[model samples]
Every structure is written in structure tokens, then in C-alpha cells.
Target: MAFDSGTVSFRRYAVMGRSPREPSEKMLQTLEGMSFAPGGSGASQEVEYGWSGGRHVLDTSFSFEHNVFGEALHFALRVDTNRVPAQIRRAYQIIEDEAASLGNAAGKKGVKHAVQRRIEADLRSGRYRRSRLMPVLWDLPRAMVYAAVSPAAQEYLLNLFERTFELRLEPLSAGRLALRRMEAAGNRRSYEDAHPTRFAGGPDGEERAPEYPWVPRGDYPRDWLGNEFLVWLWHHTETEGGVVATGRGELGVVIDELLEMHCAFGETGRDVFRASGPTRMPEAVDALFSGKVPRRIGLIVESGGSQWQLTLSAESFACAGVRLPPAEQAVSPRAVFEQRIDALRDLCETIDALYEAFLKVRFAGAWDAHVAAVRRWIARAARRQGA
Candidate 1:
């Protein structure tokens, strides 16, 4: 799907400012207090803001992030995957639910920006940007669902986060209390959309088929119950030899071309006004496979041995906000794949940075774009899901 969202690079962060803007003394002290000192087996960790002065810590995390635009703080809470025991997958309807609802979503009971202001309390309590931690893998499915919701909804979650995770609340219990609110909203919404509806046969009326042909009887899209994605990845990698499966887990699919392109963009992230474009890695992929990785290729030979030839200069890698490591640092193909993840996270952060611009997307309306993206992702995943 074009929803690949332009693999945004993972821009390194630095604490070069005070309270974002207007650099207040109070804000500086607050920022320092929120930071953690190295401790125990790991490096120094910062005290989280919401639970800074509280006794509660939960199975999940409540974090207050500093938005780059420096206009506001984005407060969020997410659940941990580890605590989602396997047994729960079968016993309950949902094994895990991790979403960051925005505080400013419409229908919330607060003045605009009121929720954002409260996030300041997190600052004073010693919960700064580092408190939530960086490079943490987000719940991709939950993020996809969030993408399905409205921006106002995103803002609303942000606001509610500020309130529920006050400096005095325990982090863990706060999560449970917050989830109750979510479940309550879900219950009411479920009934609202429960009006009876019926579907008629197709126009040709050859034979009746279910609404979702991929699903069998009594089956839902139970993500936890299935590693359907990995299953699909395994098969695809087997069939498409050019795309090798990772030795570890299948975090994502990687094209050989993306690796080369990553090497190309490796040194350019520092430019704020950098240009965005497509990569010419398909050609490079061919070179790596046929020439570099493979010594010689003779058409008349056995016509065997890893018969994978990536298209030359095929240019399948589409990128934006790509940054490469300094050429001084040795780059490898695997590094590219890892960078892809960081790039995507950076894209999310950028989407947030340009919040006002995205709000414009709300007018020209991201509705059509969103719809188009959904269709594309489904089609792509279906075609490539199992090769």
C-alpha cells in the first residue's frame, strides 16, 4: 500500500532547548527533574512524569512526549506485549489493546488546549522526553486502528492522557482505569452500530458467498490468535528467493534495492530542506546479486544456484526523509532494513511535527487519501501475503 507512509528516517534526538520554546527557567528545571539517572543493570533511566510522585505502576506505560513543533506535549499510554499472556488470547475477546487517543479529539469535555496545558504537570514531575524511552517498537496493529480513527480522536486521547496520568497517579493502575474508559466507549459504540442489516446476493447471482471470503465460519480477524503475518512472510520468502527471510524474526519485508538506497541516503539527514525522491536500487540489486554477491553468471550453465536476479535500476524503493550514516561507518544490507523501521517512526514524528499542515490535510481532507491507502494495503498484503 502507498500507506508505507514514506519510510521516514529515525532522526536522533538532542536536548538542546528549554521547554521547547520561550526557554523558561521553570521549564528547564522541570525538564531536568523529569530525566532519569543511569541505574541497575541498564543505563540511567529517567523518572516518568505521571507516576513521578505516585505509588502505582501498571502493566502498561504512560508517557508524556515533547512534540517537536514545541507547541505542546503529546501524552500517551500503551500496553506491553509481554504481559499479554498466551492463555488470555483464547480466554478473552482481545489479547491486547494499545492505542494512544489524542486529548483534542472532538466531543471531549475540555476547552481546546486545556489538555495540552495539563501535560506540563508531567514536566515538573520529572517525566521528560527520555522518560517514555526511544526506539521502542510500537504496536503496529493498534497504530493502524488509530490511523482509522479521526484526528480529533487522536487529540482527545492526548488530553485524557494528561489527566489520567497526573503526577500523583500510579502508572500501572492508571492504565487499567484508562482502559475502563476505553471499554465503556466501545460498548456504547458497539450498540449504536448494531442496527440490523442484510446483504443481497451479487448482481450475477451465480452463488452466494460470504462478505469476507478469506474468513471461515465463526472466525474473526483475531490477530493474537494467529501469526498469520509471519506465516505469509515465510511462504513469500520461500517463493521469492530474492527477498530472503531474516534469521531472527520477520519484522518486515525488505527489498534488496532499499538496502542500496539506504546506503545512498545515509549521509544526508542533517539537511532540513533536503529533497525527497525515489531510489535507483533495483539496478543496484541486480549488480549485487549477479556481479558482487555472485562471481559469474553464464546463461548456458546449469541454470541453477540461488537463481535470484533483482531487477536492475528497477527503482522500487520510494523514500522521504531518508538519512544515511556517515560513509565512515560501514553500512550493510541489514542496516538498511533496520533504518527502514526508524524511517517510518520518523515519518510518524514528522506527521506530528507538521501537525498544522496535516490539519490542512483534514480540509482537502485525508478521507480520500485514507480510503485509497486502505484499499492499497489490503490489495498489496493479499497479493504478497503468501506469494
Candidate 2:
């Protein structure tokens, strides 16, 4: 039986510049060569160094399920020196010291060299201990890539993609994403006009304590839009009963029992307040009154009688812990994979639609009234809680 059963974390990206055509046979070969085949880039070479990739995984073809097509790539990298155990280093040092104590200078030096060589060889061969597998998803129609990993690994994968395809990877920044959504909604708002405002407050030490002490200067101003979006979602769900009609259809959204709130644009007292079980708790209301807003939130989305749970970050709009609908009975692994991916895609589409609705209201000059309603809601919740 497997021991580790932790949930997979997902991070989404809008793939730019990939050819519109489906993955051709030649393209698939290139991907395989660059990933698990020999004579590839550093990532692929590293994987081979650890586990003989060409002999093991190179024969594997990219899998397709529903509209998603992609492959899983595994590789290893050097461990951080800081992470090496002190005991391990000490043992190596002791061996070197003992070797150096031998009588003849030449003999001692030779012995020391041998010991060092042995240690290096061990390290090079032990890379499998640190290997990681990153699952990449390509949405053919949308030209998007969703990786089942953290941004740290995503960076390496982006480099790999560039090396494989000979194309640049343009990350979908918040500004760009907003522009696209606005264009899709036909809002006609200039990008500059619709762009989220950045806080100009200097270093946290300079500013006097404001009435809203909990609102901290956001880590990144560009991310303010995303944070506000999540805050707005919470308010919308609470006041509107977690269901709203979009242009296409109705969306069912709710903040699950788990909610996390942090100061959006301040440095001091940037404590993260988390609430689980009933988002309407007084503690959560007090956190808002203290000027805190959502930096990330756990969400439950229902579309067409299907439900998904995911955690969305306010900064990059990156999602994690996405639990899609269960797969229907299937006779083969491929069929099951396809069903699961289709469910995941459907869930992401629902979120995108909801976000589009938010942009329409936010940029249509109705944001102030929305903010006012949120303030009143917070006040009532706080009053009821005696905070």
C-alpha cells in the first residue's frame, strides 16, 4: 500500500504562442525527446542521470482524455546545501580529516581525493531520492496549460517547454487576463481604465495606523485585483445565497467551511485569520472589520448538479486543492482519465464565467455600490457577534 496520500496542488497558466493545430506526431516525438529521451535539455538529462529515462519512460506516449492532452515528466535536481543534514556533512568531513592524517603527504592527498570522489559519486547516483514528477495539461482549444504542481516546478517546466517547442512562454499576468476577460465580455473599457489601482503607501513603518488596521499593504500591488475579486466573491455568495445568473447560465458558488483572510495591502500585523465551519462566524466578521480581506479562499462550486472544491489564491488567481466530480465507471484507465479531466475542465469554466460576471460589475461603475453593501453586511455581522 502507498503511504503518501496528500492532495495534489494545481496551478493554471494560459499558454501563449502554441500552434493552434493539435499535437502532430512530430511534435509528440519532440516532447518525448526533450522530456524522457537522451540528448535533451538539463531537465531531461537530469531525469536520465537518476533513472535512465530513455530506457524507462521515453516509450510512453502523451495521453489524451476529453479535451486535455499532455504528459507527465519526472526529473531530479541538486538538493539545497542548507537542507543537507548536519550529521551527513560531519561524517564526510570526518572521513576527509582522517584521510589527511596519513604519514606521507602524497599518500594522504591521494587517499583524500579518493574519499572525495566516492562522496561525489554517491551524490550523483542518489538523485532518485529527490526526483519529482510534474503532470502537465494542455487544453487544445483554449491554448492553456495546467500543471499539477507548484510554481517552483512550473518554472522548470516552462523552460523545458520553450526548449522543446522553440517558442517563448508568455505567462498570463493578472493585467493580461483581465484584458482578455473584458474583451470577451464586450465591456469596451480601456485596459488602463479597468486596471486595478495599486497602493502607493510607502514602507509600512511610515504610515500612521489607519481606522482599518487589518488591511495590510499587499505583497504585490498588481495582485490587488485578484484579492478584491475573492473578497467580492465572499460578499456575493453570502448576500446572494451562493447562486448567481451569468450570461450563459446560473453559477452556484460558496465559500466552504474553510476561509482565509489576510491584510490585502499592509505590512504590519499581516496576520492570516482562518475560519472553518460556517463562514458567517463572528470571528471571520471581526477579521474583516479589522481591515482584512481574502488573500485566498476555499470554494465550493456547483454547475449542472456537479460540485467541485478548490482553493484560489488572490495574487495570481492560482487554484489549488481542486476536487473534481468523481469519474463514472470505466473499463480502462484511459477512459477514467478522460472522464476526470472533463469534469475538471467543466469546473474551471464555471469559475471563469463567474469571474467574468465580477469584471462586468466591477468595471461598469457599479463597484462603489457593491462595496457599500459589503460594508453594511460586515457591520450587521459584526453587530450580531458583539465584536
Candidate 3:
């Protein structure tokens, strides 16, 4: 969905390389030059993608007013695909084969070849083409791109972005974000030495090895922090009444609507709970004690007379279905857009602050004591469930 008119959902990427903060006429011209064009020359060409105006899939005409909004440039990636149904193609092939066999027993092979060529030519003619659009927002000042696209389509965006602007896009995963924060705070060594915390003990009261299936293999070492952050949120919310103090102010966090947990060791599979206050359910506590961690969680955060709701994916730190606070009515389009962007920034900063809070206790010497407390809490929860 477009960011302008609906709940925003996107994956963030850091734009690397030299890029101008200001939107220029030259950039607009480049976008126009690379705009999507239809019709493929070869039948094997299944997909084609390029730039388009963020307003709609068919709008390739770019201008400052249409695409540029202060330091952010809004646009879209348009992808077109063509494919013939396999069943129909096979039916045609069968018909052709039967006709060829009936007409010429000796030249059946040549007739089949010609039939295949004809079918391929029809496919190349765009007989069955479909188009889709993925919105992108480039925050120039922050050097970040928020792309609303699936993981499978992300490569297309990265390639197109690099080709268009001669810049690289690096995914801003949880591990990378934590590293950046640590470096800025002069605690890089602490982050580098960090590992997953064992919050719950094993059946025999022994510590278990960390198993974080949510963190991608070979990713930055501290990616497990994201999973831990969620577990910490769960514990803190349940025990502390969900009140968190941040730089901005005090915010209330509520875990509701959805809770997804996966076996860290990839042994017990995963469980998903959907309902109001899913975290309070007994099954959720069971999943935690069974060595499952939060993979994604739906949360509501309220602060400063504003409330934001979204589902956070732990590994990539992507927010999905983000519903922001309402904006003032009867404002100009630019004003509305500005308000939305500001609200989005507020949501992001609030989350960052929460993560930083978690990092403080995580990297401190009191971490072992914190783990002991968490283990006690887990044991108490299990006892309550048994009762």
C-alpha cells in the first residue's frame, strides 16, 4: 500500500555511497529515463521492473511536486510479469502433436518444433501480463530507504536503486543497528562480545545453548539481540505494567492482537496466537518455556498524546501494518505528507530508545542477576499454568 493513504509497512535500508541530499532536476530526469517500458523481445523474459511515480502504477511522469517532499523522495518500483498457463500450453501442444501425427507421419518432429516456436512467440507478445507496484521512500537526510516490498522482490529494488543512483543499499537489520548504536556510544567492544542470554533454564536446571533461528545464519553476531529484546519486552511488560521511560518521555507498551513464537533450536516448530492480549494466554507462556522465542509481535506504544501500533519482525527489524496517530483534517496535501513523515520518525525513534534501554541492562555487569530474575519469573509462570 502507498504510504500516503494507508497503514505503512516497510523494510529499511541504509543507502551507501555519495548521494545528494537535495532532490535535483537531474535526478528527476534519470527517473524518467529509466521509467518502465512494456513488451519483451524474448519469450523467456518472465519479469521486468523499473521506476514509476509513487502515485500509481501507470504514472511514470515525474516532477518535483509529484515525487519530491522536502528531503524525502517518494517513488515506486513497477514490476511486470508474463506467463502462459501450463495447462493451456500443454493442451495446445497435445492438439498440435495429434494434428501433426495425423497429417505427416515422417515429418512429425519438424511440425512439433514449429508448434513450440508458435507457442513461444505468443508468450512473447504479452498475451498474459500482470503488473504490481511497491512504494519506496528515500529519506535523503537520513540516507535511508523505506521500501514496501516482499523479501523476494527486495533484490530488484536494490539493483534498480544502485543502477539508477550509483549507490548501494545495505539492509538495516537488528544486529547492524545495535552495532551502530554501540559504536556511537564508545561501547563497540561490549557489543562485539555479546551473545544470546539464556533466560529460562533447561529441564534439569542447566543452562541451554542459545538457538536463534530467527537470526539469519552468518549475519552479524549480535542479531540475536532482537529476539532477546522481544523476550525482554514481554517480561518487562508483564512484570512492570508495560511502562517504559525514554528520552522522549514515558511510554506505555501493550502486547496484543498477535504473538508469533518459533523454536530457537528448530525442533518444536512454531506457534502463532491471535487475539486481544495474546501474550497473557497460557499457551504463550508454554511456548516460552518450551524454548520458543518471539519471532514477531504486535505492540501498541502510547506517548505524548499519540499512539502507534505495529507488528515488528525481530530479525530484520521491519515494521508491518503500522497505524499511526491521526493527523489534523483540512490540511494541504504537502502538510498531510509532512505530518505523516514526522509521525513515522517519532515511531522509529521511540522504538530505538526502547532498544537502547534493553541494551543498557544487557551489556551491564548485572546481566547475570537479570537472567536469574527472568528464570524465576519463568518458573513462576509455569507453576501458575500447571495450577
Candidate 4:
């Protein structure tokens, strides 16, 4: 999950508030000051977290060369927690309760107090301490931070990042990005009036409200655009051949590996398809006709002479298990890192371009025509599958 090496998986965040844009003595000093410290939380605390040099759990020695690359700052968040096994704690409690019963009969209250003391003693001794590291990359030019961490770990990361750099982090989800694009394009009203489109109609040719429990129901249901984007991609790839004209040039997109769909109504649950071409599968069409929206999908994008593969989460827009094109083997480590970073940047920009294209049609006056075409395609696909 590290950005410097191996396949990367990360959630994007927009860095907010004030902070230095480049590597400086002050930034280095701040990182060192907030570096991870074992037992820093004291005996009473159960968890502790802070920044690390990202080389290892114990690597807190931050410097310009190791931590900074171009306009990006790289680091890791190290979290340690003290715990006692449930079985062990229960056994100790049983022993204490038995001792109390056999002796002065200190009662339920006394037994509970004794158990608490034992657990606290174990925590203080660090008998069951666990530690983990989450890698983070702060791209100064983009005002974005990419962190390879779980949802729970992200909370710790956000808090520690704010404390260290005096900045806030807001989730850079698909909806948020779309809103930004719409605002920039002066079509904010179009986005505000958007609503979920029913790609597949009812059996009786009656219009039905689209079931999108995950999307906010309001004038500006921007979150629903994520689902629409995936469906659009699937339709575009199947019908239009997936040749998207991006700012960087033409990019070839293929829906490959995996496709995960969930019922928008929160009723039929979810279906997952795994294959060389999951989007072309019969089951995928059935899922779409059954009021399902894609929640995640594996994508392979080719542009210029390079190809990148990654799975994208619709709502959060997180990129997971990204495989960038191979770098030259004879290059130095720094050069390799720089090459990978550039590739990642290209990948992000390509996706953004695709989204921007979708927005143009989405906010256009002829959007209804586009929706009708999509509905026709869905119906035809469903009938072909005998659904």
C-alpha cells in the first residue's frame, strides 16, 4: 500500500487551511516534533499515533531528501494500541471472582473492580501492544493528500495531520469533484437541478422513482452522479467502444477484472462479477436491469505508450490496487519514485478528464435525449439476455 513501492491503494483528501507548500526547515522540524513516540500516550491511554519517516515503524528521523520529493511530501502514520485478549481477560476475571467468593465474599462490585484493575495493569505493561503504519503522500501543487489506510485509520491520520501541519483534510469524493467542475464551468444551476435517471423503466411503461438510497434526495443530488458515471462508462464501452477524448489525448478504457453492483433500493443486495470482461457478461446486464448500480469496478486505461490498471470505488472515488506501467530497471531509486509519481499523476488526470466529459453531457440541454438513448440500450441489453 506504500506509494513509494509496490501496488498502491489510497483515498484522496483535499488539504485545507494554511500550510507550507514546499519542503523547508520549518516543515522538517514540525514533522520531527510530531514523530511517533512509543508509550507517548502514557499508561492510562490505550492508543497512540503520530507521523513516521515511512521507511519503518521506528523511522522518525525526517529529512528533506528522504521525506520530500519534488513538490510532494511523503510520510507514514504509526498507531499503537494496547489490548488484552478477550479469553485471557475473561479467565483472569473468573479467577478473581472465584477468589473473592472463596474468601471474604467481596460481591459483584468488588469482582468488577478487580477485573478492571487487571486489564489496566496489562495495558500499562504493554503486554498486548499492536502497531501499524499507514503511508501518506501530500501533493503540494494539487493541494491533495493520498493515504493508504482504512476508514478507521484515516480518522487518526486526519487528526494527526491537522495537528502536525495546521491544516484540515476534506474527503475528495466523486461528488465533491463533480461539484467543483460544475462550479468552474459556470453550470452550477444545472448541477443543482440534477436528479437520478431511471436507466431501466418499469414493465408497464410507467415512470418510477429511481431508488437511490445512497444518494441524497434534494435539488442537487450530486452524489448520484458517481453511479451514473459508472453506468455511462459501461454503456459507452459497450456501444461507443470506450474511446474517450481526454485533455491529454485519446485514452482507451476497458472495464475488466471485476464489477460490483448493488441494489439502489437497498433490497436485492449486491452482485459481483469477475472475468476478463465482466462488463460484457450476461449477469452484468441482468444486474443493471434489476435496479442495480455499480459500486466498484476494475478498469484498464491506455494512453500514449503506457497503460494503467486500477479498481475505482464509486462513492468515495478511492483507487485501489493500482498497477502502473513498468519503469526502467536501470534507473536510480529516486528516479523510479519520480517516474511512478508522474504515472500516477497521469492516471488521475485521465480519470478527471473522463469525468469532465461526462459532466458536459450531463449538464447539457439535450441530456434527456442522452438518457433516452441509455434507457433504450439498457432495455435492448436486458431483452438480449432474456431478463
Candidate 5:
């Protein structure tokens, strides 16, 4: 368990509708108490918000592309050991402390695996099981915007890591998870076997580990990415039903952007479904029936009556599928949604059957509650006459 990996990707998540509140004196004092240094009069000093440390994230990124789910203001941080300055011990202390906090955010059962828990604690203590952080990396300042997330609740406490140590970091996206994990685990890749389900093999070899039942089905092509692979998938889907695509090719363009879900997942360190826009609904049933890729999704929708508020989320969500109960094995989001879809289709079938029964017989109170006496009588007669 000797430490021997590359840079560690740390995350902190928070939720709040209120805009940035001026840091209270008590808040600043608490941070100072925690050893988070205010910007110094040295090369990295600032006049206002000098309370801010190395501002690398801001210096490197201005108005970074912001993505959200539920109610979170998401961002990233990378601790470049190659650039750490000598007077930043206090800063490193805060980073370590904040990372520890993230690891413990969910408490004892918070972590998904015992090994992950060990890694989290070890990572907080800078006791990498395989390798140490690269030397000479400099960290800059970051911000922890307010957010509110749910279900997996993984985005909790990212802002703590940001304000404490000035670093640039982001979680891995779904598709790009392979690359990110490969880097983090390095020689210790076996560590990820801890995942309840893995979206790694075959053209679609997925996770079989059902220990962590909350894991959702992924949208990635089991193992294909390039053209030939895509072609193979295209033909395969055709066999089920023609591939679902936009009439004007908008879907293709949108899909490319969606592919970055892998990167987004890695950066945010959360598994987010690569959702399709509701701009145009699917043309075929297979696209959704397979409950596979190009997920049955919507961007934003108008809810009840009329309103300007949006109802669509950028995350992947399935409304039907056989679910992995708390006691059973873990399943994918797609699986869960497919289960729901199946249930709905089944429900439809059941209702269709019941409607047929009613059509054949006139049951008591079957007519509208407000039906006129003569209308009700006529309806009853029609039912008896097989009308």
C-alpha cells in the first residue's frame, strides 16, 4: 500500500440559493484558526479579499463553463505540487483538512466502499497507498459556489477544498472515467473494483458487482468510441430499430457536447447521466425501449398550466426499469429507468385490458358523475345493446 500515484483529484460540493454573502468576521476567524492564510504582502498578495490565497483558478480561468444539477454551483481544483511555495504550509494544512472533511461528508456509511473509505482517510492524511503528489506544483485560489444536489449527494463540501488551498480541480466525467481512474489509481487500478457496477468492458460489458446497489446503468457504449465502433452500434440499434437521430442532425451535434459527460463526471467527481435534450422527442420506441444510449431525456420543460420556470435537468434520469432494491445488487441508472418504463408499459397494457372489459359491459357509476338522466339511460341501453 505504498503511495505511488499522480495528482489527486479532490472535490467539495455545496448548495445555496443565496448569492455569495460577505464572509463574516467569525467565518474569517474560523478559517484563520484553521490555518487558511489570507493573501500575503508577498508576490501573491491582494488588496481586497486578501483573505483569498493563491488565485490560480481565477487567473487560469475567467467565467469557466458552469454546469449544475438540483441546486449546486460546481467548480474544480488541481493541487499542482510542482508549484507549491515554501510559505504555504498553512495552505496545505487547510487542503488536507478540507479533503478529510469531504471523505467524511457522508459519515461512516458515507463512503461507497471500505477501500474507498481507507483511501479517503489516507488521502486526507497525504498517505497515498501507492505514490505521493508530484513535487513542484503550485496551487491557486478557487471558489466554492453554493449548490444543492441529491440522490447520490456526492457533490457535498467542494467549496471547503477550494477556499482552503488555492488549487484547480474537477471531477471525472462518465466516459472519461477510465482515463481519470487510470491516472489516479495508476498501478493500483484494481482499487476501483470497489465500484458496485463497472461500465468498462466488451462493446458494452457493464458492472456485474451488485454489492453497491445504488449504482445506475451508464450510457457509454460498452467499449466503443471511435467511428467503426459507432458504426457497429448504429447497425446493432438498427437491428432493434433504426437508430434514433434528429431530423436536422441537431442530435449529432448535441451528442458530441453530451459526450463530455465523461469529463464532467470526472471533474465533478460525480456520475452524471449524459442526457438528451427534449428539444425534439424521440422518433422511435427502440431508442428509449432499449433504455440504452441516447437516453430518453428532456432538456427543460414547461410545467403545469403555464409558467416560465423550467422542469428539465441536465442529468440522466430513467423513469422506468427493474430497480436494485436496497437488499438486492446494484444496477445502473439506465436499468432503473428501463425498469420504470417497462412497468409503465405494463401498466398501460393492464389499463388497455380493463378498458376492453368496460367496453363490453356497463358497470354501475361508469358514466360521468354529472350525466343527465336521459343521457345516462341511453348510455346504459347502448351498453346493454353492445353499442
Candidate 6:
């Protein structure tokens, strides 16, 4: 489970304005006063924020340990709802009993309203709650934070964060990411739909498979630009031996054995494709022909013998399931953490370089020719299958 996994999963954000040298005494006091029981009763433990990794005096024992990387504060926000099953049962029973008492006086809709009100009142009174203290890691240097909770809790944290710090929180989402890259690369052209491809399925009916067969069950908005990056990266790796020259060093990017693709503009119920292999398989290539683009991919980055393995989201560029190179002899945990952070930073920089390269190709009137070459490759692969 992500709750216990050491790997990092987080939403990114950029800090704006001048943050204080440290969380002030007033801010600390506010966090302490607002200490909330993640869940009411058995799990009700107050969590207070405290500075970690630096010299500091202890006020009360911190429920969640916060780490400091330069000016960035890294912590985890965790909410355990393991006790929710019992609470849900109790709430349902109460609603049923109240409905019995109300009879026809309160119709079905009225009873529902009453039940909702009762539950809300109970929640407010701390009679039935189910959040446990699990801290989210925050990294201030890059103005990024990681939250390992449900979307609902993430929204709550955002609100609470603004209340505590009095600064607006901007979620580092796909559109914002695209904008940042575009500005950095000096690619003034808009990519609202800079390129889109359509697919023509074969009579074999296998071609009817969804573009991305392994889409996680969610309603996440599509990341078109990210998908494009993955597709372009795939092409580069296929043709360039999984190695690209970067300003910093030679970056070796391998797509590993897992891949997922989504055709953002494809027909309903036909927008997903999944494949696994050292390189793109025929199925995956077919998905691409059908206008599918990559969403998430397992990648391995190598610089000399040191390597980092991770699954990255094309849109958010968030890294998860990271497996760093073997540790060097005996070292302190702090040293290990610092090394991990450095490796992660290196991976991010390499990805950024690749993205910048993609932008140069995409905006330099080369996209059309690239697309044509890709189409030719797809056709050749199809002909091979028929033969």
C-alpha cells in the first residue's frame, strides 16, 4: 500500500512570494491549536506540525515528522480510514431507525435529507469520523509537496494550508506543466491540438481493442501534451537505441516492460491500450496507429553504471515506484535519503531535457515529417503481421 511504501507519490506546486525563514511561532501555535483527530475515538490523535532535520526545541511530540531540504518542508499527510466500515454500518442503522419512526410523515426524500443532516451533525460533533494521521511529505526547494491521501482529503488539505499560511496554493497540473515547458523552450506556438492522429482498424477485429487497455479506474482528465511526450519519446527510443545526448550528460532512457496508451480523441469505449515488453510490441504499435498516446510508462535511466527505475505519469511527470541503485557499503539513513533525492533530481532534469528536445522538433516544422515517418513504420509493421 502507498501508506507504507517508501516510494514517494505527490502533487507538485510552486511556492510564490517570500516564505518566512521558518514556520513562525504563531504558525506553529496555529498548527498545534488546529490539531485534529484523523478519526474520532480510537484513532483520534492530534497531529501538530514541527520543523524536522534541523536544530530545534521540542514543544510536544510531533505525530508526523517533517523534513527540511533547504527552505522546503517535507512531510507526509496521511489519513487512515480503516475504521470507516463500522462507522458506515452505525450510520446506516441510525438512518433506518429514524426512517421507521418518521413513517409516511417524512417521505423517502425527506428521510434521506434527515439522515444526511444527522450524519453531518454527528461528524461535526465528533461522534462518527474516520481520518487517521498520515503526514504528506513536502519539499520546499522545488516548491513541491507530496500528499498520499484521497482526492477529497487533498482538497481539504489545500484549504487548511491556505488558512494556515495565508498564501494561495496552485496545484501543479498538466496545463501548468505544459506552459512552463513551452516558455522555457521559447516555443511560442500553441499546442492546443498541435497534432492529432486517427486510426483505421483492421478486419481481424483485434484492432478494435481499446487504445489503452490498462487505464486505472478513475475519471482523471486527459493529459494530451504528456501523452504526446510519451509517444515522441517512444519513437526516439525505438530509433535511437534508448540513448539521447543531453547538455548535462548522456541520458539513457529505456521504456522497460510496461506501457499504457490513451487516445484522447478516439471513439468512446475504444480509448485504451496496454502492453508489456522490452520494446514496443505489435499490439502497442497498433494502438498508436489507432491514434493512442502514452499515459504512464515504466522507465529506466542510466548514467554510466548508476541507474534509476520509476513509473512516470506523462502529464504530471510525477515519479512513483522508484527503485534506486544499490546503496554504497554502510551509510546512515540520512545519507541514503539525500542520495535518493539527488538521483530523483537528476531523473527530473533528464526528462526536462528530453521534453525540451521534443518541443524543438515539434515547433520547428518537423512534426509533419515525423508523423509521416511514424505512419510508414506502422504500415510496415502491419504488413509484416499479414505476411
Q: Which residue runs does candidate 6 get wrong by more than 4 Å? A: 1-5, 20-34, 37-66, 69-71, 78-128, 132-135, 185-222, 268-279, 327-330
The count of residue-pair clashes in candidate 4 stands at 0
lDDT of 4 by residue, 244-361 (tens): 8767788799999999998776677889999999988899998898788899999999988889899998888889999987777726888788788888888888888887888778
Flag the better candidate by lDDT, 1 or 2.
2
Model 6: per-residue Cα lDDT over 94-205, one tens digit each? 7666766768435666667666665555554555434334344445456555554454566666766667567556665544666666666565356443433333343333
Per-candidate clash tally: 35, 5, 0, 0, 74, 22
Cα lDDT tens digits for candidate 1, 1-387 = 111123121211112112133323453245334332333223222222221211122222223232111222221222111122335333332211111133333433343234334344433343333322122122222221111112223333233333432322111111122233335545433322222111112222324321322123242222111111222222233345423223221222222322221111112111111111111223322222121111111110001121111211101111233332222232753344344444344333332222222222222335356435433443344445335
Residue 99, candidate 3: Cα error in Å is 3.8
Off by over 4 Å in 1: 1-66, 70-221, 242-342, 345-387
Candidate 1 has an lDDT of 0.25
Tens digit per residue, CA lDDT, model 3, 1-387: 887767999988989988688888899899888888775343356788899986877898899999988788889999987777788788877777777778753376766786677667766777887889999988888888889988988999999999998999988878888898889989999887787777665333355676776566664556778888899899999999999876777889999999998877667889999999998899998888877889899999987888999999987889999998877882798878878877887888889888888888888899989988888898799889989
lDDT of each: 0.25, 0.57, 0.84, 0.84, 0.26, 0.56
Arrange candidates, best lDDT first: 3, 4, 2, 6, 5, 1
Model 4 misplaced regions, further than 4 Å: 202-208, 215-221
Question: Least lDDT summed over 10 consecutive residues: which range in candidate 4?
Answer: 201-210
* Model 5 residue 1 lDDT score: 8
Give candidate 5's whole-model lDDT.
0.26
Q: Write one digit per residue (lDDT tens) for candidate 2, span 1-387.
A: 000113335556666674444555565556545544332333222233111122222234432222223332222111111123456657866776665676433465676676556555555554323434455565556666666545565566567667767755555544446777767757545544544432212234225432223323334224456666776788778878888788659888878656676653454344444455446777677767656666677888888889888787766667777776776786775566656667767876787778777777778667767767777777777788994
Candidate 4: residue pairs that collide: none
**Judged by lDDT against the true structure, how good is candidate 6?**
0.56
Find the number of clashing residue pairs for candidate 6.
Answer: 22
